[model samples]
Target: MQEIVGYPLDNFSLNLRDIVDLIYFEGPLLTLFENEYGDSYLYYWCDVDEQCNRWLVFRVTRKTLRFYVTQKLSLRELIVNPVDGFLYSIELDDELQCQRCCLIQPPNLPPKYIPAVDSYYDFSKLDPEETEAKGLLLEKIWDEKHELSDLLTKLFDKPPLEMIDEPSLA
Candidate 1:
């Protein structure tokens, strides 16, 4: 099997507890979902756009803390999360006690593991031909997102605020 190589960073430690603390302590906690067992999950996106894009997803359970980096590998694949997701699972000795935290890294990892570097795609920087192609792709993406939002709104019986141009106030 070929090794997955990424960009190296000085502060690219994969300590689960440390990562969780860092995310919480840094600020602006964006919780994606929570379970019935009082366990909350967070999906920290790398970019402003949120369309099944790359993200750092984690869940804090009563006895365990898990996290992973999800990236879109291929457009042809139908998988939700990336197959090469760098995952980590940490088990707490006691409830909410991180003193005896045990981290479990996935097996068969490359000897030289590197951190992923963030990339910014500026549409304005592209040439005319490239811009047209990229613009079309982006338009399709936004269209699909809009359609999904509308479907969900109808499914949940919620008001279609996004679809409406000017909401009526009465």
Candidate 2:
């Protein structure tokens, strides 16, 4: 358990949300630490470049920790969801020296919801517009069936879109 009180701060910059954003996207392994005062912090190492790597520490509330331990919310949820108050973050160098410290204000937007059908379909090759259209279509189909197995069975019964001839557009 690393303590934050005695940690050295140098070249500290405020509002490093970009670094936090990277951590949120990468989903690195999290280590929990507590200071003598019982403040909870999550620590994770991030490699920003070939030569640069840093440790990110986020101070989280007890309620947030409880939700995480109880499996009621995921770690990513803790990062993206707006906290009751500001979320404090510390960026430390390889030697555990603080390079930046900031309070992050999470956007007041809903967490992104990934539908189950995303796992079944490969949308990586599709353009943005096509991907959105296909995703919506798949979501609708998935909702109608309410089960992946049922959706698969139904899909197998129907002719593929490519197999069906398109009407001539004169």
Top of the candidates by lDDT? 2
Error of 2 at 131 (Å): 45
The C-alpha stretches of model 2 lying farther than 4 A from their native spots are: 1-28, 45-47, 54-56, 82-84, 108-170
Worst 10 residues of 2 by lDDT: 113-122
Off by over 4 Å in 1: 1-84, 93-95, 99-148, 151-155, 165-170
Tens-digit per-residue lDDT, 93-137, candidate 2: 566456565454544212231112222222232233443443333
TM-score for model 1? Answer: 0.25
For candidate 2, the TM-score is 0.39
**Displacement of the residue 87 alpha carbon in candidate 1, Å:** 1.6
lDDT of 1 by residue, 34-99 (tens): 445434444333322222222333443322211121122221121122233433222222232222
For candidate 2, the lDDT comes to: 0.43
The residue pairs in collision within model 2 are none
